[model samples]
Target: MTKSENTLIRLEAALERILAGEPKRIPKNRKLSIRAVEEEANLGNGSCHYYSEFSSKVRILKSKQRSSSSQQEADTGFTDFLKSKAANEKRIKEKYRSENVELKKTIQQLAAEHHLFNELIRRLKTQSKQLEVENKELNVALENTRDELTQLKRERIFKLNKK
Candidate 1:
């Protein structure tokens, strides 16, 4: 039987024994075993232990429900955060793809420009060699012309001295 039922039996037995001329004193220090119920007879200090214990149980249940609801909201938020992160990652990947295409084009253009610069350098070196050869030829021609002019001046001086 439950504790309350047992208490009821104990009280009844105590009362029966008193009626049988056995007036034994009930122990004042006997703490009554209570379940989840308000024992108003034991209502002291403006609160019942059983009532407070019941209220605390109720508060705990309510708090659990509140926590469960809040956790559901957090789960929704986490899903949204994951979705946003996926969208952002997709956007970044698209950006990188486009940038990679542009970079490839730039690399191709730079390679072409590099080839043109190498060709220009080769042509410049070829032209420089041709100029050097032409310079040497011009120097030899100038020496020949100076020698002929000197010979002509020498003949003129000899003829003039003869006159």
Candidate 2:
């Protein structure tokens, strides 16, 4: 089944069980379980107007099932619970914001380190090319010196034979 259907099924089953053997009917203060289900379905905050209406209907159904004498108590309990839940939600949001800021800082640091590493690699490659050119020049100079030494030896031999 689809995700929403699955959540609705679970909500219905839990509601049935909570109300099953109650002496004075199900308590009207069931908003917590209802909201918990919404959160589980990933629709707690961003639901459309229809979701609000649906929740109201379920709440009314719960209220009607309760004893008339207990209505005032149930209403008070629901309001108090809502206040505490609102505070809890605020704290959660703040925590998430702090974590997000830390993550962004870490990502920025990693990017900078990667850029530095790339620059180091480029400089090493350039230096290697320069060293190769210098080595080739030295080899050429050594060969020229060898040729000049050979020519001088031949000239000295000719002078000694003429004497």
Give me the candidate number with maximum lDDT: 2
Report the error of model 2 at residue 101, Å.
1.0
The alpha-carbon RMSD values of the candidates against the true structure, listed in the order shown, are: 14.8, 20.5
| TM-scores of all candidate predictions against the true structure | 0.62, 0.41
Q: Residue 98: error of model 1 in Å?
A: 1.6
Q: Give candidate 1's error at residue 76 in angstroms.
A: 1.2
lDDT of each: 0.65, 0.67
Residue ranges of candidate 2 with Cα displaced over 4 Å = 1-69, 139-163
- Candidate 2 residue 54 C-alpha distance from true site, Å: 41
